[model samples]
Target: MNFRELHQDGCFLLPNAWDVGSARVLEAAGFPALATTSAGIAFSLGRADHDYGGGRVDRDTMIQRIGEIVAGVGVPVSADLEDGYADVAATISMAVEAGVAGGNIEDFTGDRARPLYDLSEATDRMVAAKEAAGGSPFFLVGRTDVLLVGGTLDEAVRRANAYLAAGADCAFVPGAADAATIGTLVRELDGPLNVVMGLTGGDLSLDDLRKLGVRRVTVGGSIARALYRHLVDAARELAEHGTFTYADDQIPQSDLNALFDPKTH
Candidate 1:
């Protein structure tokens, strides 16, 4: 499916998936496309988001997981390829061939403490991604970590437009708030707009966002974080009181296994 056309029809809600299981579940639940959540994926593998995919996430492993999700579900899979996962080693061609229909190479330098890459460096990475995506173009979501990092909204806009000129298929401002700013961003940039919808930020309804001209909404690890929070709280309760009470609220492993069962014999 071409993202150019997919992005044009209407607002596409892209709930980020962590692993094949989550991807399949979302697919079964009826999401048209899947984008990997960097935080979710890293957490699943016992790490944190942003370059904690062991700092590199084994390019082959990353590509293979993306391919698996693509094959497992009949939808376009966009990998959150965090800053192309390399400083200078990654080439544009390698990224395009990874079976990803789209991707986000954030300007974040992997630090929740310090959020964006230097503007020039970030633009270069987006350019490399564009060259990598080639003719069978996929949506390259260029994320500016402005609000998340400390860059001003104006600076984010400047960098975002620069990325668009550098060949980004879409521009994502991960921490922008409100419909008005989002509206301004959509108008200012030349490509699709990716707005992050989560608990703290981006609580706008689909209708409101469409009115604001947002092409896509990415729920980056909100679901995963919610689940993780539950697990942590449950574990804390158990460790503090030695009670198995939290187990009552859990999904059965058997049921989960049943859900992953193949339709084809």
Candidate 2:
């Protein structure tokens, strides 16, 4: 199914892949669609996610990476275009040109001093993004990081509804995981609700979120974080204890090769 159809009914897990290998792995594992994680990509590039000090990957590199993932997998790929690379219209155009099924445009500014854009400006960006997509078969996700920045639920709901009116296919509130808040947003908002999983305090299970009427659930960077946790543990073991037990449960190289091989697929 296409990316837009995935959000039409019921809640489905959209796993985020940081690279071509991970994207292919997730597709081989039978995920209907995949999303490009900004944090995951940053971590892979040896930088922090949302680095406003020019530490994160460059815009062209990110666009190329998203395009690579889209080419590597048959599943629909949605990019997590951070703040639409600070240019709403241009970023949306770039994403569509890259052949992605859809992408997210967030309202959070990378600057810590003033983390979020004003509601009016944020809505305007969403409008511009929709205009940029035009008649393309693309899903535009309007994301508000209010709760992540310690804003009230009322404010998040208001921004979500505004973004929907501005032509977002889905309203993504990243830090809303509680049942009450999820239900409230579901009831109040006039569009499909997208919630992030595995964040601090937003750990609702799939059944719980589905019951609350959430239409889309994304894990953000949690999968990458979990893999890095294992990496740290293995490195620590090898450095301190001089052991190689970490390789005991690794996937066989032939299995991975077959999975990645075009003939096998």
Candidate of highest TM-score: 2
Error of 1 at 120 (Å): 2.8
- Candidate 1: stretches off by over 4 Å: 51-58, 87-92, 111-115, 199-202, 252-255
Tell me the tens digit of each residue's lDDT in model 2 across 85-184: 7688998999999999999899899988999999999999999999999999989999999998899999999999999999999999988878988999
RMSD of 2: 1.3
Give the least accurate 10-residue stretch of model 1, judged by summed lDDT. Answer: 87-96
**Candidate 2 to truth, TM:** 0.96
Question: Relative to the unseen true structure, what is the C-alpha lDDT of residue 96 in candidate 1, on a scale of 0 to 100?
Answer: 59
lDDT of 1 by residue, 1-265 (tens): 5655678757888888888888988887777888888677767877655544245455566666666677777778887777776742253355456667878777877665556778888888888777767686677778887877666788888988889888887888987769778878888887778888884855688788888888888888898998898899898988999988888877799887777888621
Candidate 1 global CA lDDT score: 0.76
